[model samples]
Target: MTDAGVIDDYVTGLRRVLRGPRGPKIDLVAEARDSLLDAAEALEHGGLDRAGAERAAVEGFGSIGEVAPDYQETLSVPAGRRPAALLFVSVPLTTLLWSLIWRVFPTGPAAHAAWPGWFVPVARGLDILQMLVGVIGGVALLVLGRGLRRIRRPGTG
Candidate 1:
């Protein structure tokens, strides 16, 4: 099919998806149209064949809904925050629960509880640190994703 024809088909598919009421429906048709137009312009100047240009356009634009499921799972706009939040909540909670259990359990009546009791605090602190690191890493990922999106935006060099 012609490049224009292929682009139209892609747009139609995206529109059909968006028209549905399930999940995070987005205006993928508009996004594909813009991407195709940009790619078509480049191909026109670069002397690429219709098929080649269309393929490039579609591939470069990527699948609109490909990242949607991840986003939903993470409860993140771009899909990185969910894991971060999960880690942030889980680590501390798990550490505290484990610490309490460990501290309460006795290895032996003669065993000194004071020295061993410190281990629980140390483990809990490590858990908190792990959570902090995860949060920072997640934020960095989210920020990088945003930067990439900006770079891909129309009119950007």
Candidate 2:
């Protein structure tokens, strides 16, 4: 793996992963490339074997997962269920809203009566299922949010 081509391949892979959504916020793509190249140059300058230095360089870069948290703060991810709450609130509300709008502003009364005859039972069933899912998911998120808050509380440790 002392070959420049081998080193470049490793660097390219690292770059792609580092640029991915879950990757480190630090400029890891450039950093990995530069670090590998520097390692190669250092190996040559010190008269050390290329193969050993290449191995060392790869090892020193560390696993990508291990590198994520180091830069997580830069991403400013919120510490709770803000996203979850937003989703839970929006979904059922949107469904119910659309249902009401369709009922109240039907193009015609005959259409409205026909709609309930054909679709009310189905819609009611869906509403029940939606309620069950929303309750379960919301409760889970609430519990998780509370746990996170407790863990972050001062003097809790």
Best by TM-score: 2
What residue runs in model 2 are displaced by over 4 Å at the alpha carbon?
Answer: 1-34, 63-96, 102-115, 125-129, 132-157
* Local distance difference test, each candidate: 0.59, 0.57
Best by lDDT: 1
lDDT of 2 by residue, 74-108 (tens): 23233234556666686778588668857764767
Off by over 4 Å in 1: 1-3, 19-28, 64-157
RMSD of each: 11.2, 8.6
TM-score of each: 0.34, 0.39
Whole-structure CA lDDT of model 1: 0.59
